[model samples]
Target: MIWTEINGKRGSIEIVSAIYIWIMKLPEAITHVTIYSDTCSGQNRNQYIAAFLLHLVHTHKTIKVIEQKYLESGNSFMEVDSMHSAIEKEKRFTEAYSIIDWKRIMQRARSNRHNKNVTPYNVTEFLYQDMIDVKALALMIIKNKTIAEDGETVHWFENKMSMI
Candidate 1:
C-alpha cells in the first residue's frame, strides 16, 4: 500500500497515529513491511513516536517492522511535491505568506470527506464496461467464445474486463 502526504507540516501526529494503529491491527503473519514517508523535518518526531509504538508492539512477538524510510524519487512522491509547490505558489497570491498556508490547505483537503457532487459515477464510466464474471477470471486460462486464440492464458485483463 502507498500513502502520500503533501501537507507534511500539519497533522503529523494524527497521520502517524492512524498508520500505527493500522499496522498494529494487521495479522501476525505479516512479519516484514516497508513504510515510506516524505523527508519533512517536522514529521521526524512523529515518525519516531510511531516507530517507538511499533517497537512496543513487536516486543509482544507479533509482526516485525522491517524498513521505514523517506520516499525520495518515487512517482507518487514527485507528483505530490509538485502539487504541493503549486499550491504554495497559489497561496502566495492570497498573501505574501510562507508555505505554511499551502500546507494547511492540503491537510484540510486530505482530512475532509468528499462532496456529493464528486460522485464516482460523475468521474468514471467503469460501470458500463462488459467484463468477465468472477468464475471466468478465476480460471487459470479463459475460454471465452469471443476470444479466438487457442488455449491462451489470461495474464492481463483489458480495460473492458474487470480482474477477479
Candidate 2:
C-alpha cells in the first residue's frame, strides 16, 4: 500500500487497520483467521492490533476466532519473500522513478526465473486516510475493555499467549 509521508508511518494503527480491513474482505464462510505475523512489536504484536483483533472476533458475526501466530526468525521462507528478494536484488543496482515503476518492478520480479513458485502479487492498496476511523476504533477498544476487580485495572487484548 502506497501512501504519502503525511498520512502516517508503518505503525500499530496502520498495521492493525490494514489487517482489520483484510479480515473484512474474507469470504463469509471463513469464520476463523490465523494470522502468521513477523515479530515486529510496533507493526504486528502490539496492543493496538491485539485489541482490534479481539474486537473483530467478538463483534463480527461471520468471524468467530483469530489466532495470531509468530514465525521464528529466518525460518518461514515465504514465496512473497522470495519475490521481494528478487525486487531488492534488482533494485539494489537499479532505480525506480516512481510508484508505478516500482509496481512494474515487482511484477517483473514475480516473473523472474530465479524466483520460483512466485505468483503474481497485485498491489492492492487500502487508502488509510479514508479507511481508518480512529473514533470508531478507539470506541471498540474501550467497549471491549475487561475491568478487573480493583476497578483501576482495565485489560484489553491478550491475557494469554499461545504458539498455535
Candidate 3:
C-alpha cells in the first residue's frame, strides 16, 4: 500500500501503514483477518505491527479479529516463497536503484512463460496522502494498557517481538 518515499523503511511502521490502507479497502463482509508469515522480528512479528493490529480491532467496526500466525522455520515453504525466488532470479541479471525499478522487476518476474498464467502483482505507488504513522498511537495504547501476553489467542498480543 505504501512505497517510494525517499525515507521509506519497510519496518513495522511502514508495514502497519500499508496494512491499514489494505484493510480499510476490504469488503464489508470481511471481518476476521488472518496473516501467516515467517517468524521474523523485523517484519510480521513485531510490537508495532501488533499494536497497529490491536488498534484496528478496536477502531474498525467491521473487524472482529486480526490474527497473526508465525510459520515454523523448516516447514514453511509457502507459495509466496516461490514468487520471491522467481523475483530474485529475475533481479540477479539487472540492477535496481529505486523502488519503482524493484516494483517493475517484481511485476515482470511472474510474466515469464512458465508462470505466465500467474496473477500479476498489484504494486501501486503510494500517494502523498497515504503516508501514515501509528507509532505514537501505539505508544499511547502501550502506556494505557500493555499488549496482550497471549499470542495463541485471536487477539494480537503486546508481549514482545520474540514472542510473536
Candidate 4:
C-alpha cells in the first residue's frame, strides 16, 4: 500500500497522482488490481481517471488487468474508509498545518504494526500533468464498450483494460 498528502483538495489530478505513485511502488509479482473509489465525478468517476488506469495497463505489461469500481454514493464503508477514519481520529489530536505534519500524523496513526502500511505521498514527485489529456487518447484507443442492459453502468475492456 501507498499513501500521501495532496497539495490541495481531492480532485482528479490528485487522485490520479496518488494512484500513479501507488502503482509504481507495487510488487512486480502482482498481475491484477481492483480499485474501489468513491463515486465522485470530479475525482474517480471522470474520464481522466479512466485514462490513467488505461495508461497503467498500457505501460505495465506485468499488470494484465486493472479494474475500477464505484460503490453507491452513500454506501461506501470499505477498508479505505476505515483507514481514513483511523487517520482522521489521529488528526483530531494533532496540529497538522503542513504536508510534513500530515505525513507524521499518518505514519503514527498505526503503531500496532499489523495494519497495511501507510507511506506519506509527495505530490510533487509524480508529474501526472503531462498526461492530463489522456482522456482523449483513451476515448480513441478504447473501441470495445459495453453497457449493462439497465443502462446504469457501462463497461470497457480489452486484452489489458477494464473499467466500470
Candidate 5:
C-alpha cells in the first residue's frame, strides 16, 4: 500500500492492526507471513498481535512462523521514518489547533499537486476493526483446540489483566 499521511492520535495503531487482521484472514494452507513495520510502539503492538496469530497457527499445525522485522532494509527504515515524521507533523498541528481546520488544510494540500488521492482519515480505526476480527478468529481456533484435546468446555475468565 502506498504511504499516506495520518493525522489522528492512534493512526499508527490502526494501520498495524489492519495489516495484522488482513494477514490472519488468509487460508490455512498459507504457511508463512512477513510484516514490515516502523520502530514505534504501534508497530510493537502489531508484532505482538502477529505473534499471537502465529502461535495459533502453530498450535493447529497449520503453519510455521518465519522471520519478522520492523526494518527490512536501510532504505525501508528511512522511508518508514520519513512517512512517520510527516504524519507526526500533521498530528501536532491538529492537536495544537483545530482538527476541522487541519483537516481542511490537509484536504486542500492533498488536492493541490503531489498527491490527490490521499486524505487523512481514521485508517487506524479500520485496522483496529481488522485486528478485532483476527482476535476473535484466533480465540475460536483456541477454543476448538481446547475442546478437541480435553473434551470439555473451557472458558477464559479474567481476574486481572495488565499491559505491564
Candidate 6:
C-alpha cells in the first residue's frame, strides 16, 4: 500500500502516476496487470490515462498486457472503497496533527491489518508528461470507437503499447 498527500484534483495524471509507481514496484515476474476502477471520466476513464497505459507497455518490457475494467455505475462494492473505509476508520481514532502524523496513522492501520508494504509519496514525486503526442496517436489509431460509445460502461485494454 502506498499513501500520498491527498492534494490536487484526482485526475487522470494523478491516477496514472500512482499506477506507474505501483507497477514499477511490482515484482518483475508479474506481466499482466488488471485494474478495476469506477467509471469516472475525470479520473481513470480518459484518453490521457489510456496514453499512459500505452506508455507503460512501451517502457516496461515485463508488462505485456494492462486491462482497465469498470463496474456498472450503480454497483457499490469495490476494493478501493474498502481501502478508503479502512483509512477513514483509522483517522477517526487517531489524531493527525500533521501530514507525517496522518502518514503514520495510515501505516499503522495497514500494518495492523497485515499489510506490511507501505510507501509514502509526495505530490511532487509523481512523474508527469505532456501526453499530447501519445493522445494524438491513440486517437488516430482508434478511429472507429468513440469514448462514450458504451455510455456508462467501458472495458479499456492496452497491449504492446497500443490502446484499444
Which structure among the candidates has the greatest TM-score? 3
lDDT of 4 by residue, 1-164 (tens): 22234333457766776677677789999898988876677777765677678777887868878888677667557876766787788899899876667777766676545355644422343333422444465577554345534664563222122353
Residue 92, model 1, lDDT: 56
- Deviation in angstroms for 101 in model 4? 1.7
**Structure candidate 3, residue pairs in collision:** none
- In lDDT terms, how accurate is model 6? 0.62
Per-residue lDDT for 2-63 in model 1, tens only? 12343222344434544555676778788766655565544432323343444444464665
Angstrom error at residue 68, model 5: 0.8
Write the residue-wise lDDT of candidate 5 on 1-164 in tens digits: 22223422344444545555566578988776655444444434333444355554466445565444554334455544555566555566454354455545444333435465665433222322233344454455444532434576432221111121
Task: Quote the lDDT for 34 in model 3.
Answer: 82
Order by TM-score, highest first: 3, 2, 4, 6, 5, 1
What are the clash counts of all predictions, listed in order?
0, 0, 0, 1, 2, 0
Report how far off residue 43 is in candidate 6 (Å): 0.8
- For each candidate in turn, the TM-score is 0.35, 0.70, 0.75, 0.65, 0.37, 0.65
| Residue-level lDDT tens digits of model 2 in 1-164 | 54444565677777776776677789999987888776666677655666677677778989887888766667776565766787787676558886667776766665636457767556555454644554466576755445643675543233334221
TM-score of predicted structure 5 = 0.37
Candidate 1 residue 98 C-alpha distance from true site, Å: 26
Worst 10 residues of 6 by lDDT: 123-132
Angstrom error of the Cα, residue 9, model 4: value is 4.1
Best by lDDT: 3
Off by over 4 Å in 4: 1-9, 113-164
Candidate 6 lDDT tens digits, 63-143: 988888776678667976766776787789888886677767665555635554654323233223421244455565555
- TM-score of candidate 4 against the unseen true structure: 0.65
Native-structure RMSD, model 6? 6.5
Model 2 residue 126 distance off true place after TM-score fit, in angstroms: 3.7
User: 50-134, model 3: which lDDT tens digit per residue?
Assistant: 6788878888989888777677778768787887898898899779998878988887777745465677666767754565676
> What is the C-alpha local distance difference test score of each model?
0.41, 0.64, 0.70, 0.64, 0.45, 0.62
